[model samples]
Every structure is written in C-alpha cells, then in structure tokens.
Target: MRLHFHPLSPYSRKAMVAVRLRGDAVELQEVDPFSRGLRTAEFVALSPYGKMPVLETSEGPICESTSIIEYLEEQGPAVMLPPGRQRLARHWDRLADLYLMAPMAELFWRRDTPLGLKAPAVCRKTWGLLAQQLADRDFVCGDAFSLGDLSAAIASDYLVRLGLEPPAPVAAWLQRCLAVPAMAWTVELAEGHVQRFLKPLSAEFLADS
Candidate 1:
C-alpha cells in the first residue's frame, strides 16, 4: 500500500497517524496539493476527486481520510476504530472534520478576510463541546486514543498557531493526544511545512508593521 499525502494537511495527518498506529507497512508518498500535485493524471486516476491522503491498496485506491482509516481498521488490529467505541469514534471524527478542521482551514488560508475572521468563532464553538466531552476523559472516546481524538487534536494544533487556543480541558487533552508517538511525529512534520508556508506571510506582515 502507498499513502499519498501532504504533511500540512490535517486530514492527511489523521490518515497517516492511523496507518502508523495500525502498524501498516504502507509506503508514504508526499504530494504537494498546493502545486497541483493531486491533479496529475496518475494521482487523479487513484482519486477522482483529487484529494490528498489517498491509500493505494491491493484491493484498490481509497479516497477520503476517514474512508482510508476505516479501510485500514479492517486490515489491521482495529486500534483506530476499536470494537465497542466505533460509533463514538466515528461521531467525533465527523464533528472534528466538519466543525474544527473545516473552519480552521478556511481561517488558515483567508485569515485577512471577514469570513476568515469568523472562522475562529466557529472553531471555538466546537471546542466548547470538545472541552465538555474531554473534561473527565483522556481522549474524546475515553482512556484509549481512537479516531475520535485524531482529527480534533490535529486541527487544534494548527488552530493554536492561528490564535485560536483550545480551552483548558481541551488544551490538556490535546497534549495527551500529541504524546502518542505517531501523533507527535506527524505534528512535527506538519510544523516544518507550516512554517515554510507561513514564513513569507510573516515577512509581509513585519514589513507592513
């Protein structure tokens, strides 16, 4: 299996973490989505929608971060989805993707616009619910890290750089999630990409200031 991903993408990071945790020996193929790498004929053939984090499996290519993770779950020890907590994991994963990751991406790329300005508020609203859910638990689902924690934690990490810090409970939970080796490795890889992407913008801001 070959996983096509970009380090800077939260969804891709989520899939990568799942692959690592599942102990899959998949090859990692880094693609620059910003450079139209996903639009190439070879990549588009694997993923018609041209999305990052496509897993090329012997069965076939799987697109969408969640779908790839789900497919991995079937092929491995079910560490990401678990047995009884599958529903909760899926629920939080969807919520994180929709409420946290989606708005965070908008804010990231359009930080100077009105829509982007409002994005942080949307993230905060979701973080409020996440805070409540995480108050007594180590992770979104419970003691064990699951898919529930992956998407939310990755998004929160990036959102912090955007000036939208998670509340106390969620902040602590984020730390615990990052402590996972796979999560830590992916987040560190993403930080390098993010810094490179932000350096020019930071210089522009400093010049204006």
Candidate 2:
C-alpha cells in the first residue's frame, strides 16, 4: 500500500498514527496537493477529490483520515478504535468534528491573513470551545486511546505548539497519549517528519502567500 499525504496535515497525521498503532505496513509518500504536484491525471483517476492522505490499499483507494483509519483497523493486527457504546464513537466523532476540523480550518485559512485581519473574537471562541470540550475527558472518547484521541492530539498539538495549552484534565490526557508506546513511536517519527518536511513547506507557502 502507498499512502499519499502531507506530513504536517493533522488529517494525514491521524492516518499515520492509526497505521503505526495498528502495525499496518504501508509506504508513506509525501504529496503536495496545493502545489498540484499530486493529482496528476493518473492520480485523479484513483481519487477524484484529490485530497491528501489517500491510501492506495490492496482493496482500493481510501480517502479521508477517518476512512483510512477504519481501513487500517479492519485490515491490520491491532485495532485502534474500541468496540462499545456506539454513542461514544459518535461522541468522539463529534469532538473531532468540533475541535479539530473546524478550528484548524480557520487557522489554515487565516495563515495568509494577518492577525489584525483575522477575527480575534472568533479565535477566542474557537479556543474556548476546545478547552471546554477537553474539561472532563482523559481521551476524547474515554480512558483508553481511540481514533478520537489520536486525531484530537494531532490537531491540539498545533494549538499547544502555538502556546494554547489544554485545561488540566486535557493536559494530563495529552501526556498519557503521548506516553503510549504506539503513540510515542508515531510522535518520534512525526517529529522528524514535521521538522524536516512540514515546517519548511508551511513556511515557504506562508512566505509566498
């Protein structure tokens, strides 16, 4: 399997973490979607959306982080998502939907815009939502690490890096997740992937924009 992704993208990070945790064997290929370097005519034939973190699995191409994670868990030796409380899965999904995807979308767009141009009130609101969501939980879903925890961690890692720390419970949770052998392995790999690949690419894009 060949996984196409951008190292810095939280979505791509989720898929990578899932694959690593599940012990799935696949090749990671860095793809620049915005640069139009990927999604050549051939690539588009595989995934019409032309999104990053596309998994070219033995069965077929799986796009989107959640889908790729499900695929890995289904095919691999270990499972990242636990099976119980279907409502909890929904809860985890909602947390990711609310905290990770929404706020990060704002950050991504605001990358080119100056802080002055960006809405301070909106930024505060978003961060507040994140902190509030994190107030009670060890993981996004529960005690054990799940896909929710992995995705939220990667997304929240961005804010933490930017100096917005999670509330007490969430901070402890983040530390717990980080300390896991599976997550630690991914983070070790991710640190180099981000330093050597992602940060430079993001800096170049922001500079040019």
Candidate 3:
C-alpha cells in the first residue's frame, strides 16, 4: 500500500495513526498538492480533488481519510476499532468529520484567506466547543481507542498549536492517549510536520511543558 499525504494535514494523520496502530507496514509518501508548484500533474491525476491523504491499495486508490481507515480495518488485524457497534461508530466518525475536522480546517485555511483577520476568534471558538464536547470522555467513542481517538488527537494538536489547552477532562484524555506508545509515536510524527509548517505554533504548544 502507498499513502500520499501532506504532513501537516490532520486527515492524513488520521490514516497514519490507524495504519501504525494496526501494526501495518506501508509506504508513506509526502505530497503537497495544494502548494503552488509542489506536486506533479501525474500526482494530481491520482487525486483529482487535489487533496492529501490518498491511499493506493491492492484494489484501487481510495480517497478520503475515513474510507482509507475503513479499508484498513476490514483487512488489517489488531482491531483498532470495535465491531458490532457499526452504526454508533459510523456516527462518531461522522461527528469527527463535521465537528472536529471541519473547525480545524477553517482555522488552518483562514490563515491565508480573506477571513485571516478573524482567524483568532474562530480558533478560540473552536477550542471552546472542543473543550465542551470532550468534557468527560476518554476517547470520542469510549475508553478504548478507536479511529475516533486518532482523529480527535490529531485535530486537538491544532488547539495546542493555537495556545489553547483543552479543559480538565479533555486534557486528561489527551494525556492518557499520549501515554500509549502507538499514540505517542503518531504524535511525534505529527508534531514534526506541524513544526515544519508553523515554527512558532510548535513552540507555543510546548509553552506549558
């Protein structure tokens, strides 16, 4: 399997975390289809939407992080997510897409958009909502780590980058997730990508450290 991902993208991070936690060894390729002159036309053909986190599998190319994760879960072992609660798990994953990832994407994209002036307010609001939704949950779905955990953790890194730490429950949840060896490894890889994108953001994340 080949994964084409942008290092700074939480969506890509989601797929990476799922693959790594499942103990699968796949080739990782960094691509910047968004950068003005970064990617080739051939690569763009693979991702007509010009987005990162495209996974090439034995069957075909799967776009979208959630789809990639589902494919991995269907084929791989270690069962990062639980079975029998398919409906609930799907809803949680949708929540991650709508609530978690959408807000972060807004903040990240606006930094270079016309709404850049309102980025700070948007970021603060995003963090506040996240703190509320994550009030007392160890993971998005439950105590056992799932794809929801990976999505939330990667998205939360943006909160820390913006100099906003989640409230008690969320903070404790994050701490516990990081204490897991697989999660820690994923976080380290993610932090490096974040640092490369925004140097001060990385420093700000470690301010309270």
Candidate 4:
C-alpha cells in the first residue's frame, strides 16, 4: 500500500496520522498539488476529484481523508475508532472537519473576502464547543487519543500560524493532542510545508490585518 499526500494539507495530515497510529507499513508518496500534480491523468485515475491524500491499496484507491482512515481501520488494528467510543470519535471528527477545518481553509484562501473575514469567528465558536467537550476528558472522545483529535489539532496548528490561536481550554487540549508522538510527527511535517507556503504571503496577510 502507498499513500499519496501533500504535507501542507490538513486532510492529508489526518490520513497520515491514522496510518502511523495504526502502525501501518504503507509507503508514502509526496505529491505537489500546487504544481498541478493532481491534475495529471495518472493521478486523476486514482482520485477522480483530484484530491490529496489518496491511499492506494491492494483492492483499489481510497479518496477523501475520512474515507482513507476508515479503510485503514478495516485493514489493521482499530486504534483510531476504538471499541465503545466509535460514535463519539466519529461525531467530533465530523465537527472538526466541518466547523474547524472548513472555516480555516476559507480563512487561508479568502481572507480578504467577507466569508473569509467571518471564518475566525466561526472557528472561535467551534473552539468553545470543543473546549466544553474537553472539560471532563483529555481527548475528544475520552482519555485516549482517537480520530477526533487528528483533524482538530491540525486545523488549530494552522489557525495559530494565521495568528488566530484557540482560547485557553481548547489551546491546552491542542497541546495535549500534539504531545502524542504520531500527532507531533505529522504536525512537524506540516509546519515545514506551511512556512514555505505562507512565506510569500506574509506581507499580504499582515497588510490585510
């Protein structure tokens, strides 16, 4: 098995974290989507939507970060969607992808636009909900790290880069999540890509602020 991904993509980082947590032996293929790598015919055949983090397996290719993680769960030990906590894990994963990551993407790409300008407020409201969820537990679902932590942590990392750090409770939770070795590795890889991608835009983003 081989995973094709871009380090800068939170969705890609999510799938990568899942693989590492599960101790999967999949090979990594780094693709530069910004360089039109996803548009090539060879790559499109693997993922019709031309998305990053496509997992190629013996059976076929799996697209979408969540779908890739789900496929990997079936193929090996279920470290991510643990027993008795699958529902909670999936719930927070959905919320993180929708409320945290989606808005972060909007803010990154369309910061000067009206919707982009509103993204930070949306993220703050989501952070409140996440903080409430973490009040009694270390992880989103419980004490153990799960799929729910992956997406939210990655999004929060980028939010910090955008100068929109999460509030105290959520920020502490983010720190706890990143303390996991796999999460730390993924975030470190993402940090390099993010710095390179944001370097040229730093002045523009500062001026907009």
Candidate 5:
C-alpha cells in the first residue's frame, strides 16, 4: 500500500498517524498537485478532486483522510482509533477540520479571497468554541488517545500559528497531545513544509522535552 500525500497537510498527517500508530508501514509518496505548475491529469486520476493523502491499496484507491482511516479500521483492528466511541471521535475530527483547518487554509493559502480578511475573526471564534468544548478533557474523546486527538493536535499547531494564545484548558490538551511521540514525528514531517510555504517554524512544539 502507498499513501500519496502532501507532507504538511493536516488531513494527511491524521491518516499518517493512524498508519504509524498501528505498527504498520506503508509506502509514502509526496506530491503537490495543487500547485499550478505541477498539476497533472495522472494526479487527477489518482484523486478525482486532485487532493493529497489518497491511499493506494491492493483493492483500489481510497480517497479522503477519514475514509482511509475507516478503511484501515475495517481491514484490521490495529487501527489507531479506539475500539468504541466512533461517533464522538468522528465528531471531533470533523470539528477540527471545519473550524480550525478551514480558516487556517484560507489565511495561509487563499489570502486574496474575500474570506481571507475575516479569517482571524473566524479562527478566534473557533478557538473559543473548541477551548470550551475541550475544557474538561485531556483528549478530544475523553482520557484515551484516539484518531480524534491526532487530527486535533495538528489543528492545535495551526491555532498556535494563528497567534491567539490557546486558552488554559486547550493549552493543557495541546501539551498532552504534543507529548505523544507520534505527534512529534508528524510535526517534524510537517515543519519544513510549513516553513517553506508559510512562516518560519518554531521548535516550541517539542513539548515533551
């Protein structure tokens, strides 16, 4: 199996985390089909929407990050997601993608669009909501680490980049997630890409140290 993904894509990071934490290895291929000069029909065929993080399997291609995770779970119980509480985990993943990633992408990549100017405000509200929702939990879906927290950790990185200090509870949650070894590895995969595309990277994420 192979995963075609962008190194810094948060969606890709979550799926990658799932694969690694399962104690399995899949070939990884990095691509940037979204770049104007790099786009190609072959890439489009691999992913109809020309997106990154498509998993190529013996059966066929599995698109979408969450769908790929679900495929992994169906194929083996070694999936990183917890055995139960599927609904809650999925909700956390969706919430991060919607509230956190959406605004971060608009601000970082689509700055010229009309929504760009409002990105800060949108992210502020999102941060507040997530902070409140996460107020009493160490992880997104309770005390256990699951697929939900994996994606949320990546979103928390963007939340830091957004420059609004995370609230106390959220900060505590971020600390716990960043302390995960897999999270550090994922961030190392992401840092260079983010530094190349957005801003200077920081080493503060090594919270375990």
Candidate 6:
C-alpha cells in the first residue's frame, strides 16, 4: 500500500504515525498539496476530495486521514488506540481537524497577510480547550496512548511554532508523546516544512492567479 502525504499535514502525520506504529509495510508517497496536480482527474480518481494521506490499498484507495488511519488499524494488533476509548479518540480527532487544520490552511493564502495573523489567537483558544481536557490525564484520553494522543500531538505543533505554551499538563503530555520513536520521526520530518515546502504555495498561487 502507498500512503500519499506531506509531512507537514497534521492529518497526514496522524496517519503516518499509525502506519509506522503498526509496523505496516506501506510506502510513503509525497504529494504536494499546493500543486494543481491534485485536481487532475487521475489523482481525483483515487481520492474524490483530492487530499493528502490517501491510502492506495489492494482493496482500493481510502480517502481522508481519519479513514486511512482506521484502515491501517485493521491491518495489525490495533495498539494505536485502547479498547473502549474510541469515543474519546474521535473527540480529539474532531478537535484537531476542526480547529488546527483550518488555520494551517490559512497559511496558504494568509502566510503573510493580515488574515493569517488572526489565526494564532483563534488556534490558541482551541489549544486551551484541549489543555483543559488533558489536565488530569497523561494522554488525551487517559494513562494509555490512543488516537487522541496522536491528534493532539499533531495539532499542538501550531502552538509550538508560535512559541505559545499550553497548560502545564498539556505541555508535559506533548513532550511525552514526542518522545515516542515514531512520533519523533514524524516531527523531524515535519520540521521546516511550513517555511520551506508549504509557504511557497502562497507565491505559486498568487503567480497563477
């Protein structure tokens, strides 16, 4: 199977972490989300949404980051989540997707625009809510790691980049999550992607416009 993604995409990172943790023999394929190539009929055939982290599997292509992660979970021992914590996992997943992904997307057009400046404050609020949830738990859901932890790990990168500190417990949890080998690798790959890879999209889009 091939996982199409860019390391900078939190959604993609979430899926990648699950794949690596599962020890699945899937291949990684970099897809530039900023490029019009994603809109071409060919890629769209695989993912109707034409988004990253689409999994090309023997059964067929799986679109959406959450969907791909769920697919990968079925391939192995299912350690990415603890039993009965699926609801909590889904909650965190939605939190990240709704809050973080939106602002990260603004970096495309608002990378230098006044609108972009507004994103961080909005994002910080969401981070506070997340921190409140993690006040008593080491991980997002609890003591055991779950998909929620992965979601928070990815979303919190925004706060880190902004140099904004989450609550003490949330900050501690972020450190612990990054210490995991798979997550460490994910963060390393994601480093500088915003500056080097994704920021260029703003220029490219303006030129095309």
What are the RMSDs of all candidates, in order? 3.6, 5.4, 4.7, 2.5, 5.4, 5.5
Models 1 onward score TM values of 0.91, 0.73, 0.77, 0.92, 0.85, 0.82
lDDT, candidates in the order shown: 0.85, 0.64, 0.67, 0.85, 0.74, 0.75
Model 6's TM-score against the true structure: 0.82
Residue range 34-140, candidate 6, lDDT tens digits: 77857878789998988777899999999988888887776757777667887888888787777766665665446556655665666667778878887787887
- The TM-score that candidate 1 achieves is 0.91
By TM-score, the candidates rank as: 4, 1, 5, 6, 3, 2
Residues 1-209 of candidate 4 have per-residue lDDT tens digits of 99999888889999998888899998999998878999999999999999988999999999999989989888768899988988888998998899889988987777768767677777888899998998998888888999978788889888877777678988898888889999889878877767766522255554454
The collision pairs in model 1 are none
Candidate 6 residue spans exceeding 4 A from truth: 107-118, 197-209
Candidate of highest TM-score: 4
lDDT of 2 at 165: 46
Q: Comparing 3 and 5 by TM-score, which wins?
A: 5
The whole-model C-alpha lDDT of candidate 3 against the native structure comes to: 0.67
After TM-score superposition, the amount by which residue 123's alpha carbon in candidate 3 deviates from its true location, in angstroms, is 7.3
Which stretches of model 4 miss by more than 4 angstroms? 199-209
Q: Give the range of the ten consecutive residues with the poorest summed lDDT in model 3.
A: 199-208
Better of 4 and 6 by TM-score: 4
